[model samples]
Target: MSHSVEVYAPQNWTVEQWNFVVWSEGAPSNTFGRSYATADWLLTQTAVRPLVGIVCGSGLGGLADLLKDQVAFNYRDIPNFPQSTVHGHAGRLVFGTLKGRPCVCMQGRFHLYEGYPIQKITLPMRIFKLMGVETVILTNAAGGLNQDYKVGDIMIIKDHLNMPGFAGNNPLAGPNDERFGVRFPCMSDAYDRELQQLAVDVGTELGYRDFLREGVYCVLGGPSFETIAECRMLHKLGADAVGMSTVHEVIVARHCGMRVFALSLITNQAVMDYDSEEKANHEEVLQTGKQRAEQLERLVSTMVTRIEYNNNYS
Candidate 1:
């Protein structure tokens, strides 16, 4: 049975006749039913049983190579899945072992700015839930909004400011599917506290002291970078990091009762007041991500190792 959700479009959206598209067929069994089914089907063909799911951020697909014996599946092969179209996104899922733990990772991700609905953007995490992913590590490339943060630093997501989804446009806006979660899921400490500590511990152990930071992440709808005014406003709003992804995935993962930990790679500084001739762009973001890719890889590998060890020994 397909679930129909009631969506409220913003007043500005009415001029464009932006209405919620009702899906009537092949609806997810639960909120995460379809993707879970697809992922489970894929996992059955492989020997690995994933303990966690990881999503690679823009220009960060290369991180999947760190996994051993990867079984890759294109997004097109999955039923009810959205294809990734961004330049940095690879549109494939890699199932393998990362740091000796069974893991499945997305080499790319769909964005709301890519014309995909919020539900489609978060569908993969639902699949992760079905695949028995008890925890999720979401990584994204973002422009730095905090004054103290520098490019190439990794920021652990402690909380989020979901300005887009809460404004009547949400992946969970439609009908409440009780199988996935309750109608009103609480957002307090949505990012698991213990998991956050584990990430921090790993970062500290690896001697990435100054390069690692933790703060609130703010998500925005964007194919374009934010303006100076917007960046300053976000900073004033208590956001330590700003990005275009992660928030939706975090919400879906949390709704499915999975533990979530998100990290943001600071690609560029949103320096609106700078008088120098520097600016933030996609090329710059990708280059910075590439330069810091090894750091991110090590950080993630260490964190995963810790999670598996603690979960197994405890």
Candidate 2:
């Protein structure tokens, strides 16, 4: 006997119907179940049990190459994983050791502008927690919003303004899962303080004080760069960096009780003056990443070692 299975064709669905079927279901329990399934499959593929999870931002995917004894899986090969749509994103998960600490790195990350449901974008955070990862290091390429910031600088994320969340577009918008976190999670301490300080100390030790900074990052829904007016308003609102990713991932990681540390590589200066000839472009972002990639790698690797030492001693 033979059995046939039917799959729903999204192409035939109306726009409203599609939205309802995807986002309206919220963070379904099955999402958690599928994450476990994915995690199990990963375990079978590699002997590495990671304690740290890193998500590469924009052009920062080179960080993953520093890992030793690596095992990698393409997004297309991973069950239920979303493929990256942006250039400069390699769309792979790499498992290995960085400075003797077991880590899993997402060579690429998903974004809201990619048309993925918010829950889907953050699913990896929960999977990281389940895989026994206690710390998450997030990196991104951002436009400098502070007047004092210049292109090719690195900013440790101190806080964030979720511009999209203010309008009800939040990763945690779905029904709360007690298995993952409380119904109301605090954002007050979203970015780990000690890690921020550790990054500062690491950068200083690496002689990166001249360009190292710490400040608030504001997230805007983008595939589009901010307009001059928007850039000016963000600067006045106290943001030092602006980008399309990271904020949502941090929220999800914190919700699941993982320690979070994030940094932004200032790829370009946001145009706050209409008369200015400056424009924000992805090509410039990629170029800046290449320019500062080595230093950023050194700083993060040093921090990872320090974190491992601290965990062992304290």
Top TM-score prediction, candidate number: 2
**Backbone Cα, N, C clashes tallied per candidate:** 4, 0
Q: For model 1, how does the per-residue alpha-carbon lDDT over 1-314 read when each residue is reduced to its tens digit?
A: 01111111123433122212223354433444455445546766777778788899988887788999988888888666789888888898898998689898899998899999898889887777666677899999988888889998999999999989768777778787765677777778688888888878888888888899899999999878887788889999999888889999888888877888888999998866857566779888889889989988898888887774224210
TM-score of each model, paired residue for residue: 0.87, 0.90
- Candidate 1 segments exceeding 4 Å error: 1-33, 274-276, 308-314
Compose the digit string of candidate 2's lDDT tens values, residues 1-314.
Answer: 00100011223646455345434454365566556556657777888888889999888999999999999999999877888999989999999999899899999999999999998899888778767777899999999999899998999999999999999999888677776778788999999999999999999889999999999999999989999989889988989999999999999999888889999999999988878997789999999999999999899988888884225210
* Alpha-carbon lDDT, every model: 0.79, 0.86
Name the regions of candidate 2 deviating beyond 4 angstroms.
1-28, 308-314
Model 2 / residue 77 / CA error / Å: 0.6
TM-score of 1: 0.87
